[model samples]
Target: MDEEDSQIQKTQLAMTVPTTRVDVLVIGAGQAGLATGYRLAQEGVSFLIVDENQQIGDSWRKRYDSLTLFTPRSLNALPGKVLDGDPDGYPSRDEFADYLANYALHYNLPVQTNFRIASLDIEAEALFWAEGADGSAILARAVVVATGGFQVPVIPEIAGTFSPQVRQLTPETYKGPADVEHGPVVVVGDGASGRDIAFELSAFKSVILSRGRNRRLLPEKLFGISMWKWLKVLGLLRAGPNSPLGRAMRKSDPFPSRERSDRDLEKRGVVLASRLIGANGKRAVFADGSTLDVGAVIWCVGYHDDFTWLMIKAAKDQTGSIVVKDGRSPVPGLFFIGRPWQRNRASALVTGSTADAQRLVDDVEQYLSSTRQGEGSIALVAK
Candidate 1:
């Protein structure tokens, strides 16, 4: 087609896309999004929650099969619903997923599943636009990005060097040992995920745990009381980021297992190795210059914050993490929720969502009030 004809067709197609308008637009329907939505509802604000997945809690459901929460049911509840089960017992991944789904249903939150946001931009002062993967869009007075901190899986550069016959998978894709070939498996990373998977795989195959640093273990219970209960008594979980206890907690890793130490794992027939450095054909190389012959590799390297689709310059930091001060962005009407240390270390957990959402919704309400009163503007000049 001629250039003039193509231009006209593109213009027509763009005009055909539908646009929605709301007071607030939430970009995810996960625990963070639902928490924010519940608070928004309480404030009598018009809002909607949109998710990329077809189901409300499919994100958790898609995790590796044997996954379970480290936090007990009592501390895993979100907003208005308490997990109805053994208070001291951790819930399986599937059970948590079901709880999230039920939480949305119980609250009757307005959620549009399978609606992935493609781009977010400011159309004008106090006016924001969120374009979806589909042709639809939402124009809002305020935007809450509740997509959580875990957006992209992180695999190291050396993973590509493995032989084609050797299977390599990330925790997000690894279901169980049955998915691995009938041979030894090397699990990389020393985080909770790596240790958990290694523990499960040790029963069937020779498992190697390759890690950089040893984690400090916390007893699941102290004097017959759960560790979470002790943290509550100490007020550590609720401490502000600048507080002394909060600072120390943030510097430390999440509490590890009291029952499983390196020695314990070794006793269980799980070999502990140094950090994985690279791979040579079928051989897995470690930072200690040692090599392990394995049939499969599992990378539990964790995730990164991804906001590439967000077109606002004031929305993200140099590392692509969302920038917010007490949940409010520099741009007047834009906010971020479910970010690690967003307000406190608990900000990313289900138990912490209620407090985080409460504070953030208050900010959103104040921003909306100021904009309505002609106190300030939301126009953010691109940096």
Candidate 2:
């Protein structure tokens, strides 16, 4: 049989299985999903958390190998779990991933991995049918979309102009310096990922960091205390995106530490390049009319919010981002957690998921209560 026909047969075979029904389905088994699940457990709510990966916390594992969060172990944690070891010390990618797995095991949250929510739609009142990639489906009453941000990587279309000799990669694919090609490397976008990647690569390769937005860099420490402590004390991280402080934060970037400053980057031999404008062959064209030929290009251009799998159009705005106000969507049974600026600047960070989760769980319970009142069906979270 042809490949297409074989795939069709497989999907048909998958559809033969009965759809599992639940009161709440929290999508994405990463830190966000686990945190939300913990809250549901506290409320004794019937819920299930599902992820596309074979294991929980695989999302963090997918990042570059040398990655270490600026947020310390103590600050970034789920509702009930404490990331062990020194509270002030940063946790490496692997360490955090293991913690997530252990958190699920400790709490025994109802988590099902490798269950990809391919698409979702609401047919009956308050009901969501989340179809799996395998053609299987789940029925739920209320959905907590704790998938977190960073859904789809953003690569400029101009990258196609580069010749085959130049290797291109994204954060999802590039693991370490070994993944990069020989010769100079041009890292695009100046976000946290781009900055870290450039700094790490500078030790081994000639790296040029393509600067983007000019973010305000805060000192790692204020007085003798850590900057994180100050943010939490003054409620800076907790500020909403629409709040006066949140609006100010949106205009400015809170750099983790001063060591990552441009001066330090220059000291470490990381060339600060202008905005990336175009590319052809091995030439990386910059906005400053300067160009460089590099062996490989790492696009750290952040991500676009992808709700394509979520077939609903009621809440999504023109930019495809869900129209969420304080983590609750306009859709009755749909809610979100782990959204950047959902409540404030902290909402996107691993440290921030629990805050959103608490509110979202309460929203879910309220939604389900209404469903019960109306004898309505359940909804599903499409990650």
Identify the leading candidate in terms of TM-score: 2
Model 1 CA deviation exceeding 4 Å by range: 1-15, 241-244, 318-321, 374-383
TM-score each candidate: 0.91, 0.91
lDDT of 2 at 201: 90
Model 1, span 1-383: residue lDDT tens: 85467446534644677766678898888889999999998888888889999999999999999899878888888878899899999999999999989999999998889998888877645578788899777778899999888877898888889998889898899999889875689989877788888888998999999987656668788899998778767876777788887777766665747456677789889999998888998899888898977899998988986788997887778877667787788887999898877777678777788898998899888878877775443232211
Tens digit of lDDT per residue, candidate 2, span 74-101? 8877887788888888899999999999
lDDT of each: 0.83, 0.83
